[model samples]
Target: MKLFLVRGTAKGTLVPRSALCEPRAPHFLHEPPARVEFLNGTGAVVPCVVHGSPPPRVTWTTRAGQPLHEVPGLRHMRPDGSLVLPPFRAEDFKEDVHSAVYRCLGTNSLGTIGSHDVRVRAGERLGTLSV
Candidate 1:
């Protein structure tokens, strides 16, 4: 028996199947986080979703240039790329360190992409007085 193989054509050129498929770079599937305000002693979440051919690593950074992993128990990145900020105590507000901008970065073999700046603010609860 005799047989022949056929290849796909693109732009009038015969192309191999392998050449037709290429890996796509990472990209944001949804808009980045926006300005969010959380009452002191309340939790907050920032969502960041990305898409790519090989998937990507998600990282979070604070306005002070501190990495999320270094923040200890105060903040962390969820499995789904959401930044979780746990409830802040009154003392946390005193230094105004918890209130700052946050940024999300996605990285893959192709390249790296950054999300829009997200401003996170922690404010004192209503009717609460500082001693």
Candidate 2:
């Protein structure tokens, strides 16, 4: 089993176990897209990326704690270390679109890491209204 030490919480911080530290489990980080553009009538396209060490797994999920694959209209693609969305349905888009919470999860044989939530929106261009 892999060993992990979580930090940065309200519970305060803990000292690093330098005596028992090991470098077997490579560090992992996610490179999720900072922004996503939702065009008119086409669908939403979200790109999830991963950074840091290799051999990682990436997936998405909803704020309701529902698995992404279980959610409709959400398509996931695994290519290299990027998650591609061919297209999303209008109906499904309604669920995760506009102020909805979508999370990108990355995992490796050693541990798992997730990126900041990517908010989906329905608009044309930044600061432009869709009519």
Candidate 3:
């Protein structure tokens, strides 16, 4: 008898792998938090947890379905199940943050899972700023 490994991707189709080749494991959501906080001057930070026979490749995207670019202000964790936002600046809030959205992506040899949409906003002040 002989054993074979099958691999798959979002595009479709599966291929066989040699015994030496590492098999792709299914990426599962382990401890992904439902909601997170966006600090007053700090950007949003969401934690992602995943486990499987093989670790998963993690990435992030905006709610609007935009890919997160590798920049100073924005950042993400690799195979680990963690995320970070370097630092938030005024320009990051200049945009329409009211409609901003955040999401977590996890992909492994087996499959992938994404977190729910995370909305970011500026904290409210009790008293109004008077001139």
Candidate 4:
């Protein structure tokens, strides 16, 4: 990814000074799976590994462009680019989070890239009974 360096552009838009190599757009190192399933009240993690010349900032969002953090019970973990889905009771299930397709975006000075869609859902949990 070459920097156009247009006039009046912010200096921060250029490649990081610490980076020695040429600027490169973000690419996925490890993409999230097609689907992630967890039991009710059990949490799950969706990992998205992205690498670039100057390191990109990863953000999670739904396929519909809704930010992952905007969804209740979902957390965007920093420094690792992983989405954390917090545990919640069956009655507290949110369709927006449980039945949504998520995608991770890696953005940097060079460019931005998006990961494949990943569907997240929580199955009903059954309790054991002793006679």
* lDDT of each residue in 22-52, candidate 2, tens digit only: 3333233435565555654454556565543
**Rank order by lDDT, top first?**
4, 1, 3, 2
Clash pairs, model 1 backbone: none
Give the alpha carbon lDDT tens digit for every residue of 54-83 in model 1.
Answer: 688888876665676735557778899988
Q: What is the C-alpha lDDT of each candidate?
A: 0.71, 0.54, 0.56, 0.76
What is the RMSD of candidate 1? 7.7
Which number leads on TM-score? Answer: 4
The predicted structure with the larger TM-score, 1 or 4, is: 4
Which 10 consecutive residues of model 3 have the lowest summed lDDT?
Answer: 122-131
RMSD of each: 7.7, 10.9, 9.9, 9.4
How many residue pairs clash (N, CA or C atoms closer than 3 angstroms) in each of the candidate models, in the order given?
0, 0, 5, 0
Better of 1 and 4 by lDDT: 4
The order by descending TM-score is: 4, 1, 3, 2
Query: Which ranges in model 4 have alpha carbons more than 4 Å from their true place?
Result: 1-20, 70-74, 126-131
Angstrom error at residue 5, model 3: 23
